[model samples]
Target: MTSAAGATALVLALNKPVYPLYVWFLAESAFHLSLLTALTMPLYLAVWHLSRSGKGRAARLGMVIVGIVDTLAIALILGGESETLAFLFACLMLAGLSFYRSEVWLSRGLVAAIFVLFVALEGRIGAPLMPVEEDDMRSLAFLNVTGAAALAAFIMLRFPRAERPD
Candidate 1:
C-alpha cells in the first residue's frame, strides 16, 4: 500500500508540469491528486504498525477501508471515468487477497461494498468536480491506468504462494 501510494504520488507529481499544456483543469487536478496520495502514506504506515502489533484483522480491515474510501473519493473527484474505476476493482482484489478462508464473510462484504459503490457511481456522475478537456481526459486515463495496474501488480506479487509438494 505504501508503494502504491508512492507510485501514485510520483506519477501525479511527474505529470504536474505537463498538465498545464493540455488543460487548466489538469494542473489543479494533478496538484490535488498528488496531495491526496501523499497524505495516504501515513495511514498505510499506521496500518502496517497495526499488523505488526498482532492486530491482523483490524489492520486488514483498516487497509481495505482506507483504500476503498480513498479510491471512492478520487473517483468522485474524477467523475465516472473507466480509468478511475480501475482502482475500485483493485480494492476488490485487495479485499479478496487480504482475508483467509475462515474470514470469507469479511472479504465478501468488502467486495460487495466496492461493487455497489462502483455501480452506483459509474456513468451516474454527470461531470467531474474538476472537468478536463477531451484530450486531457485521454492523458489522465493513461496515467490512471498505469497507476492502477502497477498497484494491482504490487498487491498480487505480495500475496503468499502455496508451496509445491516435493
Candidate 2:
C-alpha cells in the first residue's frame, strides 16, 4: 500500500479497541458479537497488512489506534452509564489487538490500565464482577482475555522494537 493508504489504515486501528467492549461486556444477543466482529474485519485486515511490509508509519499508527480506541470506548461507556460486561469484553479484545500489532511497553501498559479501571469501575459501581451461578462460560472468557493480555505483554517485552528515525 502507498504511504497515505498505510497511514489511513493505521489510523483506523483506533477502532480496534472498540470491539471487545461489545464482545465481552454489552452484548446480550449472539447478533451483537457476530455483528461487531464483522464490523471489525477491515480493522484486522489493515493490521495484517501493516504488520507485513507496510512500513513503520502504518504499523505504528495501527498500534496507537488500537490503544486509544479501547481507552476511549471505555471512557465513553463508563461515563455514559452503559458500562456492561460486553463493552469491557470488547475492550479486552482491543488490548489483544494492540499486543499483536506493536511490540511496545505502552501497548501493554494501556491494557493494564484499562483492566484496573474496568475492575474498579464495575466493583465501585456494584456491577457484577463474577458470573451468575451458572455462567461459568462468561467467567472463563474473562480469565481467558486476561491470560491472553499477559501473554501478549510478555511477548512484546521479550521482543523490543527498534526505534525508528524521524
Candidate 3:
C-alpha cells in the first residue's frame, strides 16, 4: 500500500470521521494516507533496512509495506498508538520466528500471558483506548493476548522441553 493509503485506512479505522490532526489542514484521503505512511517512519525504515536475503529489494519493500500497513491497521483500530500494542506484537512475531527457528521455549508463561492479554484487549470488554474517543479496546487486548499465546505455543512446540541434566 502507498503510505497515504495506509494512513487513510488507519485514520478511518481509528478515527472514523477521518479528517486530520487539524481539520483546517484541508486534505484528501490520499493526503491522509500519506500522513499515515509518514507516521510509521521508524518501522518502515527498519523493516526496509534489516531484511536482507536472497530476496530482492522489491520483496523486502513489499513485505515491509505489508507488515507496516497491517500493523498500523491492527494498532489504530484496536489499541491506539499509545498502547504500543503494535510494537509488542511485532516483537512477539519476530521473537517467535527467531526462537522457534532455534527451538526454544524458556519464556512460555510470558508468551501465554501476552497472548491472552492481546485477545482480551479487543472485542471483549471492548472500548477504544483511553482518549482515542472510540470503543474497541477489548478487541485489541484480546488479539494481543492471542498473538502472545500463539507465539508461546510455537516456541514450546519447536523447542525441546526443559529438563534437568543428570
The per-model lDDT (C-alpha) reads 0.64, 0.44, 0.39
Tens-digit per-residue lDDT, 65-157, candidate 1: 767766766666666652677788778877887777889998999999889988887777555675566666676777677767877887777
Q: In terms of lDDT, which candidate is stronger, 1 or 2? A: 1
Q: What TM-score, computed on C-alpha atoms, does each candidate reach?
A: 0.73, 0.37, 0.30
- Tell me which of candidates 1 and 3 scores higher on TM-score: 1
For residues 71-130, could you state the per-residue lDDT of candidate 2 as single tens digits? Answer: 344333332223333344444544444343445565577567667766766534432232
Q: Which candidate order results from sorting by TM-score in descending order? A: 1, 2, 3
Q: Is candidate 2 or candidate 3 better by TM-score?
A: 2
lDDT of 2: 0.44
Residue ranges of candidate 1 with Cα displaced over 4 Å: 1-34, 163-166
User: lDDT order of candidates, best first?
Assistant: 1, 2, 3
Worst 10 residues of 1 by lDDT: 1-10
lDDT tens string, model 3, 82-152? 24353346434433333322334523543464466556644333322333322233333344455445534
Per-prediction RMSD in angstroms? 5.1, 9.3, 12.2
